[model samples]
Target: MLTPEFSITQDDDFIFICIKIAAIRFSAANLEMLVDENLFIFHLSPYYLRLRFTQHLVDDERSNAEFKSQDETIRIRIPKATKGEFFDDLDLPTKLLARKGDILGADAVKAPSKSNAGPLIQEIDTPGENGNLEQAGEDFNWEISQTPMPPSDATRLLTSKYGFDDNYSSVIGVSIANGNDINELDDPEKSNAEDRVQERLRKENLKFDPEYYVSEYMTAKYGNEDDIQINGIKSLLKFTPPLVKKFLKWYKQADDKEAVMSVEFTEVEQQQMQKNLPKKTYLVDDVKKLYITMLSLLFAYMYEQVENEGVHNTESAWTIGKLAPQLSFLDQQVITESAASELSVIKAIVLTGIRRSLSYPLHRNFDLSIKVWNYVYYTLRGGKRLVIQALLDLHEVFRFHDVYYVYNTVLISDLCAWFIIAGNENIIRSLAIELKKELDQVTKKDIDFDCVCGIDESSGEVSWENMNIEEMEILSEQEYLQQSGRPA
Candidate 1:
């Protein structure tokens, strides 16, 4: 009772079977195979061999077998009976069912299994039973070594859960064969929003310059209105007073003492606040440069409250981009570590949260890091270069604010993109390896996230994990600014 080692892999249309064998001399008579819906058999010389598939290939008629010249590997490629589905009764064991662990070769190394499912299958073959090739070969008989479990679990898993009818491969916006458009069918609200945003972005020739954006938005929305007329005359920000308060308070608490000074006042702020925070005030002047930066922070605040009346998320985009630099380390770690397969889910979840905390049983909505970096780089001036420092500063201020969940939301995949933008390839690679190591044990759930290393332990009564302010690795802003090539 000898069973040859084999590995089975599958993609959308094809099932790939690899049979490893010792070198067999090439001859039409010596090497032959029989492939069909129920079984796959391979023969080498007088010693006959055969294998039964768990699922029959749909196009077994088109199945191709080739013996690779190197590695003595016999390869059989069979297209799944259906486009994306293999046969439900095709005959694979439960060992191949579990997603965990790897299946090994034929050396009785028993394809790595988490648990035994009954006994091993040892099948013997007699020539000609499976029609080995001499004018349909000769009479051959095959044996089954280990009988797999009744098809209940694997069949349910294969047919019901594991995408037999699931349109997981369908493109989001495009129409499929039934004329079903996911954008139209799945979530119209989100789809419409994306279309509107994408269209508006293209239409407006929108620039990130806060002062100049009015020719693009405000006047367009409210023509000749008093606030608009007043702001047009003075060039005051529509949301400055509120954001300024948050900014000044954040400045006092954050480690970056001189960041507030980076606010270079233009003619606008000079006219608007000449008394308290005048242009060229004793401490700092002309708040022109950091207006976009400050605007970004304010937008995060707006994003937090965007669900309220008359608050548009798209309006906050350019402004929110400016503060992308202020993302926290915890956020960065999560963004980089999140699974690639989980991206769309993360994006959807992230969009849903919108500067808010997610509830438990977290459904992988980890899109913040990706989106933040994307918009920041796309919309903010020199954002790709300055963001890492901003993220560092953000960690300081937010950790001080003690808003763990909101902080986590900011460091989404966009942050990982930022690392790439910063040319931190080696560092990003290290982080990915680190993330894979972390995932090896526990999954990346939204929990007590930390900066330095490893997942932060869960703090009581909080979203993700909350750590004390003292436990954080807050980089002093003064030091980073001095060394970071930031403008004085």
Candidate 2:
């Protein structure tokens, strides 16, 4: 008897077939008393056999009635070999499990439990061949290799992962080592160079003459006062009651006993006698002399300031205006012009004197004195109308000629022209034109007026054209006598 849960199979070598038997039927123990009971079974038709197999395996059922209907059977029983191969060919988990257990296990176990259980083989279908799979693996590796490394942890990871000691030193050790010499690297020579430069600057700043600088600054801003004191004639000459009394005391001590006792001596004399003699005379003389000296000094000082201090144009003009009053007073005292005819010549002489005096070391303090003298001289000599008026004061004076000579002699003509261009163009142009004409006329003329005068021989006048024998003889004798008596 076969249990329901168990399957039985049989093979027929004649048909080369394998079959499963679900249940086997057998007759019960003997109907008649016999030596042994014999089992009797009915023979199964081929169709019924097939039907039974279909019911049990293909239809997934085991029934005797279904087994009889082989003609109605829609299912076919697949061979074990075919089923095993189908499962092994699948890539699904169930197929893989069947192949691993049924095929490989069967080989290891050496089992023949199922007939026709040959080696389980499979044909697997894939989108690509094995070559494509290898290529894909290579591509994946390349992609990973090409990927950019993260910056944040690259340094740390490079040394830690790759055994790169240089990277490790750069990342960590560099920072620690750099701290000691960072300042030196920032500005290596700064401290020493700064000290040297600062020391030089300090010495330079201290080199200037502070007092002289201050005095110049003050004078340029406020103008000079020494001129006022020196040239203040009216102030000095004014007689106060105290001064008169002092003068009287001075007179009394002058050893004028008779004059002091005599009633005939006027009040002036009495007052003079009452004054302190030495002190009054000294003060009077000192004040006069001091004022003159101071005036000269101031002129020289102003001149120096203009020339050396680079004063020009408007500044020069302003300086001139400030100095003019003192200069006028000095000019008036030095220059003595009484007649109109003498005016031009006296002016020339006076200007020359002023220029000469200012050039001396004693009067060198008068700034721009030389420049001013030169400007006035050439401008006037150019025959400039305005200059003539400016110098002559309507009538040519000794002062005008003096000024002209000084200017013409001392000034460079080009410099004078530049100054004239600024403020005196009309006069300068006219003068230049007139001077040019005069020069042209003088240059073109060949006749000598002095020679013409000498040629007019009459009325006891000697003739230059033909000298008389007596005159020629006298002139020769005089020349010989003069030459023979010479110092040499």
lDDT of all predictions, in order shown? 0.31, 0.25
Candidate 2 structure quality by residue, lDDT tens digits, 1-488: 21111112222211011222233432223211111111111123221221111111121232121121333221222223223222211111111112112322222212222333221101111112223222322222111011223568554443321001111122222322443211111222222222322332232223223233323323332344774344332232232222223333544464531121111223332222222111110111111222222223233323423342422232332233223222211221222222223433223222333333222322221122333333332333222222312322211111133222221121112112212122232223222222222222321011111111233336766443322222333444565457769432
Q: How close to the true structure is residue 117 of candidate 1, measured as C-alpha lDDT?
A: 24
For 1-488, candidate 1 gives per-residue lDDT tens digits of: 23344556677888777766664565655767766774566676633445444456554467787877788777888776667764431222222221211112112112223242211101111111111111110111111012223555554333221000111222222222433211112322122212332332222122122223223233433346775564342232222322333343544465533121232223332222212110110111111112222323433443332212224233222223222322210111112122323532223223222222211111112232223222222212222223333333333333233223233232322222222122221222222222222222332232222222234357443233233222221223334346767753
Candidate 1 segments exceeding 4 Å error: 46-49, 59-61, 86-488
Candidate 1 TM-score to native:
0.19
Worst 10 residues of 2 by lDDT: 276-285
Count clashes in each candidate, considering only residues at least 3 apart in sequence or on different chains.
47, 36
- Model 2 TM-score on a 0 to 1 scale: 0.15
Please, what is the TM-score per model?
A: 0.19, 0.15
